[model samples]
Target: MVNDSLPPNQRRFFLTIILGGLSTALAVVAGWPLFRFLSPDTGGADVEIVEIPRASVDVGGAHFLTYRGRPVVVLQKSAGEFAAFSAVCTHLGCIVKWVSDPGEFLCPCHAGRFSTDGAVLGGPPPKPLEPIPVVLAGDLLRIG
Candidate 1:
């Protein structure tokens, strides 16, 4: 129970303060979930489209970039054909390195190898590297 020794006005003041504090706290508690749901999630991928110049990726070579916060590699297979793949290794989540000399992606962690099309070629990776969507629009290679 609240102390009764204080003057009436003082007690009312204290009660008002407590009531205001509780109201504010309740507002915060009730609004927290709604605020979180309406807020933009900065930690997740939010990019809608990524564009790369066609000339940036040469024929038989690779261009590396971050696609929606994941490592991605783009390769020009031919004059008008292009391919894109996630550079992350399927076995251990290591970023794969493109070796132009060997024409393969090498995961240094486990020696996992992947072909230009992201197919697992050798070593410990259980699956192919994830393929990313690519479209050629005029001079731009639209990637997602």
Candidate 2:
């Protein structure tokens, strides 16, 4: 018959090992999703919509707006047509600047440049700017 009672040292050692294993397993399960959530870009699957007032933006100009308090760039193509893209640079997290003279978005940190259409013309950026889907409903512009 197995002894039901053991010395204090033996009991403590077994308990510690069991607890350690449990802790490690718990960390692996919980940490994976947490790390992914905290990542800057969760791939291209997640897209959202943002709205801006028509009068608030200028034609041939890029407006820095916010949606849900997150920064975004709104580009006015004409009187009512507009396109939107995330201000975040593809190369790095640095915010991109809209230079009206060249009709391009420039990342000052690394000289990354993106055309008005969000195409990466020249720079270290691996991909073109992230285009946010847009729709104009009366005076409101929605980007997703």
Candidate 3:
């Protein structure tokens, strides 16, 4: 409780200090998540490789996965060949989908299309899908 004996000016000063401190604390609490999200990945471990079983991806099919919190796609182009690319659309931040019949990646947000090889096919996408490295180890696929 505020001291009843305190002068009006002093009481106002004390209240101002308390309110300022509280508002500062509240701002920090609310802003921390936004700050972290906007900040780049500093001092974070780089995702070098990700292992996935061959059986999980069918022939001529695409498999979606996450790498370091980013979306990624692994496409089995043929019986023994597999390719990987970023699932993020180049035009915008929308995720791309695998269109099996046409054998391409489609961004539902803007109708952007990308070839199975990650090349741009149609719509507003400015560039091809970003390629990721993929290697076959025994019956597993290693992606980076």
TM-score, candidate 1, is 0.71
TM-score of each: 0.71, 0.67, 0.70
Q: Supply candidate 3's per-residue lDDT for 21.
A: 99
Model 2, span 14-121: residue lDDT tens:
999999999999999999999988887534434456556777779988888765445679989777778888899999879999998877899999999998888998
Q: Say which prediction, candidate 1 or candidate 2, comes out ahead on TM-score.
A: 1
Candidate 2: what lDDT?
0.83
True-vs-predicted CA distance for residue 12, candidate 2, Å: 5.2
lDDT of 1: 0.90
Pairs of residues at least 3 apart in sequence or in different chains that clash in candidate 1: none
Model 3: pairs clashing at backbone N, Cα or C within 3 Å:
none
The list of candidate 3 runs beyond 4 A from truth reads 1-45
Instruction: Give candidate 1 regions above 4 Å deviation.
Output: 1-44
Best by TM-score: 1
- The sequence of per-residue lDDT tens digits that candidate 3 reaches over residues 17-122 is 9999999999999899989989887432376678999888999999999886688999999998899999999997899999999798999999999998899999
